[model samples]
Target: MAASSKRTICIVSPGTARDNNGNWHTADRWARFLRDDYDVVVQERWSARWPAPDLLVALHARRSARSLGEFREYHDDRPAILVLTGTDVYHDIHRDSDAECAVLLADALVVLQPAAIGELPDIVRPNTHVIYQSADALPTLPGVPGRKDVTMVGHLREVKDPATFMRAAALVTAPGVFLQQIGAALDADLERLAERTNDTVEHYAWQGGAPREYARDAIRRSHALAVCSTMEGGANVIVEAITSGVPVLASDISGNRGMLGDDYAGFFPVGDAAALARLIDRSVQDDAFIATLRAQCAARAPLFAPEAERAALLRLVDNLFHSIPSIGKRT
Candidate 1:
C-alpha cells in the first residue's frame, strides 16, 4: 500500500476471536464495515514484531489493556480509538488501573450503546461517542401463531445469570408457555443449575451452545427474547433481537435500558425470578402487552440497522483523520 492510498487501520482485541460468536462477532462486524474505505486488520493482540498501522481501534478496556498501553508507548501521536465492553464499563474501569489507563491513552472512545456515556468520568466524556451496535436483518420466518415460546441467548457466566431464566420458568404457571436458554456454560455453578433445572418438570430446556446461525434462527422463531444480565456495556444480542423484530423482556439495567429505551415497558428487576416470571406470563396471556413491546422494539429497530452503523463508523474515521495532525499526514 502507498502513502497516498487509504490508511491501514488495525483493530486490537486481546480477548478471544470467533468467526461468528458473541463479542468477536461485534469486532468482525466493524472490520467488515470498514473494509471498503480502509485497509483493516483484526487481531487478538499487538506485539513488538507487528508493523505499526495508521490508526488503532482496540476493544474491551480490560482485556486489551496491555495492547492499549503498548500502542500508546509506540504510537502516542497516532489516532487510537478504544471501544468499551460490558465488563470494562461495569466493573474494570472502576477497579482496575490498567483498564483506567487505557481510557486516558486513547485519542477517542466508542461505546456500543447510548447509556454507557454516563458511566465515563468527566474528562473522558468529551471524547466518547455512542455507536449503537448494528445487525443484518434476517429473513423473517412465517409467524407461528399461538406458540408460547420465550428464548434467552447468552453464554452462562456470572454476569449473564442463566439461572434467573431457569427459575423464572419454574414460577410460570401458564399452560402452554415454554422457556429455552441457549449458550455455552462458562461457570460451573451455572452448569449445575442447568442440570438441576432440566431434571425437574418445569417447562424449561437447556439447549446448550448452538452455532450462531442456529441461535439467531431460534431468536427469529420465538415470541420474545429474555435478557437477564446483571451488567452489560452493550449487548449485541439486544441488536440481534431488535433486528429480528423479536420483542424483548430485559433486566432493568442501564445497559439494557440503553438498547431498549428507558421508557420501555418490559423490564423486570435484575435477578428477580418472580418478576421475570410475571412478565413472561403477562407476555403470553395479554395480547395488548406483547403487541406494545413489539411496537416499541419495532420503533427502535432502525437504530441497529447495518447502514446506520456503517455511516457512523465512516464518519468517525473521516473526522478523526481531518482533526488529527499526525494522522492526516499519512494520506
Candidate 2:
C-alpha cells in the first residue's frame, strides 16, 4: 500500500552548497529524487534545532559523525543510513574513531559502487548496499567540430592525481590529441604543477573549475574521459560520462572497477602515466578500441539511469523502516 503521509528525511553532507564537489552533487541529487515521496532537506550538518526528521542519511561517516551520533542517541531505532566516501572507506574508517562510530550507529550503509562494499568491515558488510550514482540517458550527439580532447574532471587533490593525466599527455604517441583538465585546485603545489605542465606539455590545457553544465558539456563532446583517481567511493564523473555516451579511461582501482566492471579494457594502472599514455595512444590511433570502450560504457548506462537509482534508494529506505519496530514511534 502507498504511504498515508509524507515522511521527512534529512541529509547530512559536509560539502557546502558552493563547494561543487561530489558529496554536494550526491546530496543535491538524492534530495530531488526523494522530494516526491518525502519531504527532503539537504543540510551541511544535522542539528537538533527546529524539528526531528523521520530518517537521516549522512554522507561521509567521519565528516558527518557528530550529526549521526546525535540522531542515533536520541532515537536508536529510527532509520539512519551512512553513505561512505573515498576517504571514509580508503582511510578513515580503519583508524578514525568517529567514522567507526558512524558505522556502528547506522541501520544501513550505502556504497556508491559495488567494490566499495569490500572496503567495509565484516560486521558492516551485511547492511551495506551499492547504489550506483546516475545521470539521465542523453541521446548520442554528433561529434564536436574541434581538435580531439580527452577531459578529466575532479579537483586537483592528491587523491585525484591530476599529475598522471599531465604526464600521460606528454607520453602519448597519438597525433592531434589534446588533454583538457577540469576542476579547481585543492593543492597549491598541484595548481602550480598544472600551470607548468600546460606551458610545457604539447596540446594540454587546464581549464580550472567550471560550472556543472560546462563540465558535462565538455565530457559529452570529448573523445573520451580520463579518471586517474588514486581512491574513490565512486566518481560521479564516471556516471556522467557513461550516461552522456562518452567512454572513460580510468585508473584500475576498486572504485573504478566496481563502476566499469573488472574486465573493462579502458583502465590503466594507478599512477602509471606511461601505461595511460599507451592506452590513450591506442584510443587515438585505433577506432576499434574507442568503439569497444564506448560499447562497454553504453551497456553500463542502464544501471545509472535516474529511475533505477531512485527505485533502489526508495527500496533501501523502505525496507529499513519496515524492519525496525520503532521507526514510526520516534518523535
Candidate 3:
C-alpha cells in the first residue's frame, strides 16, 4: 500500500493515554503495528462528525458499544471489528444488552487470547479471531543475589483481586523473599488495605503506579511476576513478563491458562492467598521449578513477538477488506 492510498482504520477505545490501562495500551500498540500499511486513527469514540473509515477496531464491547453501533449504522458496507475485553467476555457480554448488540453489530470479533473464544456466543464463533497483543523483548536483569522479588502489576480493582496478593505477602515465609505491588489504587478501600499491609508486612512494599519504564525494569529484574486477576482478556503484563524472561505466577483462570497454556506449572487457585503464598515461597526456594517456569515462558514468548502480532493484525485486516470485493481497496 502506498502512503496516500492506504485504507483508514479507526480504533475506538474507551481509555486514553492518561488512563494507562490495558485497553489504551492495546489501541496504541495496534495503531503502531497497522500504521505501516493503513492510516490508523485512535480515538475515544467514533461519531458522524468524523469521516468514515474503512474499518473500525473498537475496544471493550460494552464501553465502545455506542461508537461501534454508530460506525456500523453510518457505513454498513464497511467492516467493523469488535475487540473483546476481559469484562466483556467474562461478565458484560452475557448480561449487558449493549455489549450483546456490539457483538451482533460487528462484522468480526477479536479476542486477546484463545481461552476467551469459549466465552463468546456460538452464533458468532465463526467470525471470531484471536489476536494476542505483543511487547518488545527486554533483557533479563539478574535478581539480587541475596534476595528475590515477586511483583504484581495491575490496578487495585475487584476483578484484579489485589487483596489475594496482599494476603499472600503476609503468608510468604521463604528466606530473603520480597513481595512488590505496583499499580495505582483505583479504589480507596484497596489503597488503605495496601497501606496497612505495607505497614505490617516485613517483606512487602506497595509502590503505587510508577512510570512504564520503571514497571518494565521491575519485571526484568524480578524473580517472578505475579498476576492475581480473576478475569483477564490475555494480560499484557503476562506478555511483558514472558518477553522479559521473567516467569509468571498466575491465577488458575481460563484467561491466564489461555496465555500460559494448560500444562504450565505456575498457577495457583484464584483468590487463594495461601496457595499463592506457597507458590511464591516455592518459586524462591525451588530452583528447578523456577527453571521449568523460565523454559515454559520462553516457549510461549515467540507468540508475543512484535513481528508475529503485526503479521496477524495485518492479515486479519487484509482478509476482512478482501471479503468484500466492492470495498476491498479504498481509493
* Candidate achieving the largest TM-score: 3
Error of 2 at 268 (Å): 0.7
Clashing pairs in 1: 86-233
Worst 10 residues of 3 by lDDT: 322-331
Top lDDT model: 3
- Least accurate 10 contiguous residues by lDDT in model 2: 322-331
Q: Write the per-residue lDDT of candidate 3 for residues 1-331, one digit (tens) a residue.
A: 5533778899999998899999999999999999988889999999977888888999999999999988888889999999999999999999999999999999889998999999999999999999898899989898778889999998898899999999999999999988999999999999999999999999999999887778989999999999999899999999999999999999999999999999999999999999999999998889899999999999999999999999998899999989875663644
Position 268, candidate 1: lDDT: 96
Q: Give per-model TM-scores.
A: 0.95, 0.95, 0.97
Candidate 1, residues 205-264, lDDT tens digits: the string is 899888888888888888889999999987888888889889999999999999999999
Clash counts for all predictions: 1, 0, 0
State the local distance difference test value for candidate 2: 0.90
- The local distance difference test score of model 1 is 0.86
Runs in model 2 with CA error above 4 Å? 1-5, 140-146, 325-331
Off by over 4 Å in 3: 1-4, 328-331
